[model samples]
Target: MNAPMAVESARSVATRFADCRDRRIAYRELGSGEPLILCLRFRGVLDSWDPAFLDSLAKSFRVITFDYSGLGQSTGEPSYRSEALARDAIDLADALGIEKFAIAGWSLGGLAAQVVACLIPDRITHAVLIGAAPPGKVENPSEPIFLERALKPINDLEDETILFFEPASPESRAAAAASRKRIEERSADRSPAVAPEIYLKLLQDRAAEDAFPDIDGYAEFLANAGIPILVITGDHEIVFPAPNWFALNRVWKSLHLLVLPQMGHGPQHEVPEMAAEFIASFVRHRSKSQPA
Candidate 1:
């Protein structure tokens, strides 16, 4: 019953690749105990994760994160669909000899995590969705201005602040600044930047997929899957607001929600230790309640 150890910076974690199917997936593994695979947000590479957040989770569980097929150092064409990304995750876990594990997906990654749970119910123990848009039609799509600002080349700290944090809140802005510094800690041996064409395609694909009618079935799948789920969000997430997922409380059989006040899209970055401790506790409680 002791507290988990502090996680080191992402720069300190060594990068490795696993050969899965036709692609070589670039990934980093940290911590120990049960495995937890984290999926990245849109156009995000392995480096996009917050170091302090990853470090905190690594303190209790073996946290593994990777670039999708065509992103970062991974080789292959970038997939536009969440299902395709989920398949890559399964492949990576298989290559690593992991039989069962938990999954945490952020933003677009959250969509993929739901697909993973649905497709392989027996393989996943717990699921955590952070600032994630629910499956089905996106009622509150991101503003065009926000996407325009985010996709542009990173010119200054202001650029990142606008993309990930709230401009109006001083506290949110400061957290975004700290998170940016942590991401920059790894200068040498950094993963490749996402290609412009690939990034655009991902955005297009997300828009197209969001229009599909069948995407709404994901909620039904999760309700019946019997897996425990933890949904984390910032109260003021401009892109994917907290209330969207909060509405799912009526349907999701085993659901837990955490909404950090005065935060935006990246709540984990704003409250890394709190988020990590919640995940650890959720996973531990679920494990104990499951049939042995």
Candidate 2:
């Protein structure tokens, strides 16, 4: 595990906004170099990400984190559908005058990352998915317990551990505690959590078919995009199981996987620095095959 770089902590970064079409998107950025836009998880606000993870990632790239419209500190309507979520990232990029960049998404955000790649393949340099569900049918779908736990309006550390980390493992539980503390370190410019009424309906809408997006030819796009993708996941993730991805070993041509044992959906929380390293290394080393 590497120590977080001496760069500014995510907790203190100033939140900025860009006028993307009808709405203003809330965002915070750190580091320097390649622009890396990160999409949030389901019901995740700008403050939801572990600062340790963001701080570590800042060492290698210009990490930009943002809140989807109407969900956090941003304005306008919010939709959980993959396409709408994808527009959030793309619109923000245009608003910020960014021509090309890498995109990373966690869990549900991963769906949007893939969509962005398809929508603007010429502009996306790379795509990194952390605990994200793959496109199309999964051989191992998510368990029902996720919705049961996720529907809650507020989550305690225990709820977070069960939902994102492995409660069954003492090591994971400890990591969860530390991760939670780091997430709470941000006391300023934090976005409010999505209300239960708002998120419950969103979750319910996505309950069917393991909450995977219904994009046409999504799987085919990945097989053909030839964009460098790095999937960092945990072995014990219940919601988006690793086995589902393993079954498609022959599907992705320029894909790489990192499955950590005794971990769950949020490997970035369990091993923030290590996961960040993996992401940075993947971007630095992967040979890109741009579509001709």
Candidate 3:
């Protein structure tokens, strides 16, 4: 008998493309069942995701990861704003004939997730925000060193350690190294790293130092929209602090917050299985908060 030819996982999955809104969006999907679209963080591409995280999520949800229009492996007139990114997700869904599904985003992509959930709450089953920020003013904003490092043409292991992991904790730093290895394990057909010029312009033009810009009216939708939201964050989040979520406790009708200890912005990468379990359990049980 012949051995399995391909592993149904991120490491060896082929990149697929879909035409949407005059652009070709590059994406990859694995597993089966409920559709769950994942939005990448700033400077994040398909390869940027931790394979362990993707594999774990794949077990339950048909996790879809894609590049924004005109970024990474996608093609079309490029855009860097949150709404543009959200539109990309919506377009991809339409192209794939996926009417309703769950949406998850990290970092800047979190903002895009919020936009999609709010714009079409009827189409979203659940909104998952991982290391994502809330709408409105940023309370805990980012540190200068973050932007300084982000502006670099290329990031090294040390930069990855500081950017995503909690440096003060040995365990977190060690996890960061392992995550980096898993991400790079994909040797062939990897999505290109987002160029500094493109992602940098987003920081300079729209976002301020260490803070994600606010989109007007999103707060009200979050406050009243019957969407169940699960926000996962690390205890020591430098990019968008965990406390920011606390500032709005009970303010959001259906909110479940999970703060992992000794973790940073990339909690999913730090403990992929643990984070994936939380997501799987959350999505499986329907909340009464859904709009009827």
Candidate 4:
């Protein structure tokens, strides 16, 4: 009898494309549609996207996923400015011949998305933020809790996984274990120019730096930009809590919120169906009413 096939969980497919001046950036593309949704993760590589999450979203829209330079397959060791990352996202859209689309980002990518929207508001139709904070600025969590995460040492996979979730359930634990195994296997095969020290420095800078030029006061930008914005956070999320969403709610015109009961930083990965539904609903509502 033939052996059973291995369950392939990493739905991330690899591709290298020119960002600007023919600079190569590694990315993954799935599904197909108008108003494509681009996903930008925190500090994780393209493969870090949960397969189930991608599979679910792929069923609905053409999703574009990519690794920020210096962290994944992209070739770079130089410290990048947030503006450069934002520019890269715009360049990516240009490369794909997409005029305007929806954008979703988490953590650092969330900060980058804000910059992208501000830089080229004409090119982004809708925006969503999940467990995200302004660069060098965070809300919801008390100062002490924020400091704790900033100081936590992400030396190993186990420690890092815990930060992504809160009160980890059995399913989440199993997913973490499976993902760790895949990361270990993949890391053994290829290495990038990521500087662990640089990553650590970024965490410190994000915590200590009192000002971020591009995204310091995101509420003001959101209120002025006049775009449909959806801010979501897990009720149990430790990174950015529901109050942060509430904080932003005070400043924007067409802002909405979705608070999940038992999700975490990566809601799209931890609770994909819920996230996808919320996103699709947001897009549908906005597209029908607005002409962006």
Candidate 5:
């Protein structure tokens, strides 16, 4: 594993806003720049976001990240469909008074990112999809035996640990373990029943079955727009698996795929500095190509 990068000593800003639908969205804001980048997690609360990762991006752009309505601090009952999740992102952006912005989503958030990009292409200038797929079209971690057990009420913690980190590296394993504890702690306050229902609903809501705005064949969308895209996966990510990215590449050859060695699913938390630098570079280059 690479050494953790030291984060800049900038104070992180936090906020809460009501979406058009009246759902309360909680977010953290830091740094300043054009194309206000929106960071959304795969399947956790905004607090579960890695401060180090946010700090890394804050150096280059105004980063805004928030929790999906059903998860984290966002208020509302969870809905499993990608369209519902996508609406939350759009409404959250509108609520924040943002019209155009770059968006990067990791894991499930990546799925949401794809939906948003297609649904509101004009609003998204650039997109970064990390370890995520457009529902139904890609493999899901829920199929794994380990993942099946891990998704179980409280007992799934150990399995989640095994799937989330690189077992070969103690540091990676340790990080995953720590993250598991934090997620578990966050779950403590909510009824255990809520999480399982959310996960099941998300799994069943398959993005492919739903109508999304920007999807015209994933590869076709990228090629036609020549929009900047960064598709990355950990060399050892067992959850999403590396082969899935090949499917993505087949559609978008220009899609930059970086298979980081000795990494796992939670790259943002495991190596925030590396992720930040990569995303920062993408956001900068794309911002420069367009009229300011």
Candidate 6:
């Protein structure tokens, strides 16, 4: 596989907006190759991605990161449903004149990615899920403390560390600090943080009894779609443990799972270069395996 380019800070990339339906979606593009759309995690804005991770992926492919509707610089009322978010992603891709692309989604974004693969199987060439919550009802819900912290306004870097990393490890905590510094690099024209009300609404929606249903059907849909999928997670992920994704292996015909040791919920941020390498390798392998 080709090596990734020199690391560039994500904050240095120019932000652009695309008109999709009635909403304007904010996004950033880097490097150049087959387009790879990165769906944002819950309450995440375009500026939240780890720069090293973005830069690494950009070396091998066109990387596109965008904010969801009603979040960050985008203008629209945000919806809590994953299906709605998936539609917004498709709309943004359409507006950008991108007919087909690979997708990488983290946390809640992963859920939306799955829905997208099902909705537009032909358009999505590959799928990557990182620290993603599994489809259907969550047998092990997020801890009360974590949920409470996430709903509260982020007062500073400490809050972010608590929300995104494991507190027990100094290494993980250090990684969180570095990630926060990178996120704050773009001081001017930065996208606005997600509003508290929107965050609460999303949490409420996820907590609903029917938040996820018919998981088996969703799994079968992905299996039939036959899209290559890469699932990565930290072994210590508190929000959605790595084992949670193992269940999909039985149903997803083309799935590869990677669990990094001594990491937390934000594995990409914690180990950006490694995560990028895994992603690039997966795409490269897929490309080679395809029939000419």
Off by over 4 Å in 1: 1-9, 211-216, 287-292
In candidate 6, how many Å is residue 180 off? 1.0
For model 5, what is the C-alpha lDDT against the true structure? 0.64
Model 4 spans > 4 angstroms off: 1-12, 35-39, 76-81, 134-157, 168-193, 201-208, 211-218, 288-292
Candidate 5 Cα misplacement greater than 4 A, ranges: 1-13, 35-42, 134-146, 155-160, 177-194, 201-219, 247-250, 286-292
Per-residue lDDT tens digits for candidate 3, residues 1-292, read 9887765889999999998968899999999989999998988888899999999999999999999888889998666678888999999999999999999999988888999998888899899999888987776877787877777898898898888888898988899999999988999998888777777676576655334455567887787787889999989888888999996778888888999998888999999999999999999995637443
Top lDDT hit:
2
- Listed in order, each prediction's TM-score against the native is 0.91, 0.95, 0.95, 0.78, 0.77, 0.90
lDDT scores for all predictions? Answer: 0.81, 0.88, 0.87, 0.62, 0.64, 0.81
lDDT of 6 by residue, 116-229 (tens): 887887788899998887576666666666676767776477776766777778998899999888777778878888888778876676665553554447766776566888
What tens-digit string does per-residue lDDT give for candidate 5 at 1-292? 9999765432334354566576787666677885454545444666556566677788888787776776666788666455677788888788778898887777767777777776777788788877665434454443365456545755454555565567788788787776555444433223113366676666566554632233446435554455566766777766566676676665554466778778767676677778889887876665413311
For candidate 5, the clash count comes to: 4
Residues 1-292 of candidate 1 have per-residue lDDT tens digits of 9999865567777889999998899999998999999998877888889888898898889999999998888888788588888988899999999999998898878888888887887999999999887777666766565677767755367866766677778987898889888888887767787777777877776664552234647778787577898998887777777777767786777778888888778888877888899999999887513421
Off by over 4 Å in 6: 1-9, 209-211, 287-292
Candidate 2's TM-score? 0.95
lDDT of 2 at 86: 94
Q: Candidate 4 on 168-213: residue-level lDDT in tens?
A: 6776666566655554543332325345676666556555444345
Q: What is the number of backbone collisions in each predicted candidate, taken in the order shown? A: 0, 0, 1, 0, 4, 0
Which runs of model 2 end up more than 4 angstroms from their true locations?
1-6, 205-210, 290-292
Task: Rate residue 76 of model 2 by lDDT.
Answer: 88
In candidate 6, clashing pairs total: 0
Regarding lDDT, does 2 or 4 come out ahead? 2
